[model samples]
Target: MPHCVILYTPNIEPKTDLGALCRKLADTMLTVRDEAGKQVFPTGGVRVLAYPAAHYAVADGKGDYAFVYLNVRMGAGRSAAVQKAAGDRLMEVAKEHFAPIFEQAPIGITLQIDESPGQVYDGKHSSLHPLFNK
Candidate 1:
């Protein structure tokens, strides 16, 4: 299971569309899955969530900042060891796709798999929680 999360602080602009960014990132994630032959989240499994940084007082008062969290759930068939292996693959894809976006503004971006115990898959399923919530 491969999942991705993308969060960013955009440069000062007339309008900041976090939704667009989320969609772009999601699309990038899909590409990564295709290229890597790795399942990020599950087939037909993708979710995009966005939150204004101001909601959490992140990056000053400018809500232009955003947090994007993605979760990919693979199922319980894969063992924890295999899940982690898959996660590593997905991480590589995330870094490649996200690096350019982060370089543009140098905003806080975090992408990783969710290894937390309470995650949707955890040990029961092969899931990746790559989050970029900055």
Candidate 2:
């Protein structure tokens, strides 16, 4: 599987429809294809989870928020060039999809490739998490 993880805390508006936003983001990520005409995303296996911040103290806090986590698994045999291309494409799509919401937030923003299990040139592995493992 592709050995990269992109994790970001999208600064959403307080009390926004996070479920809808998550669905949209997931859809955008799932459909990305590489230049070789190969499907770069997992086979109906991308996972998106929305969790409210643990620091949420006030029930009526105007800045209440959730975390959007996206996980993708790709074939381990794919070339490094293909993997990088795919990852770059996915991030680009994500930024475009979430641009409007992010622009309105107080904090600027950060998108990170939090976990990369393989070498930048070549490697192989799979990722299983609490949400998708089930």
Top lDDT model: 2
lDDT of each: 0.48, 0.52
* Worst window of 10 by summed lDDT in candidate 1: 125-134
lDDT, candidate 2, 43-123, per-residue tens? 445556555444433323466333444455554566767667656765676566666666564333234333345647653
Tens digit of per-residue lDDT, candidate 1, span 1-134: 33444443334222345566556656655543333465444434455555443434455755545333345444344556656665565555545545555555433434545544445534423234333311
The true-structure Cα RMSD of candidate 1 reads 9.0
Q: What RMSD does model 2 have?
A: 7.8
Candidate 2, pairs of clashing residues: 1-74, 1-76, 2-74
* Number of the top TM-score candidate: 2
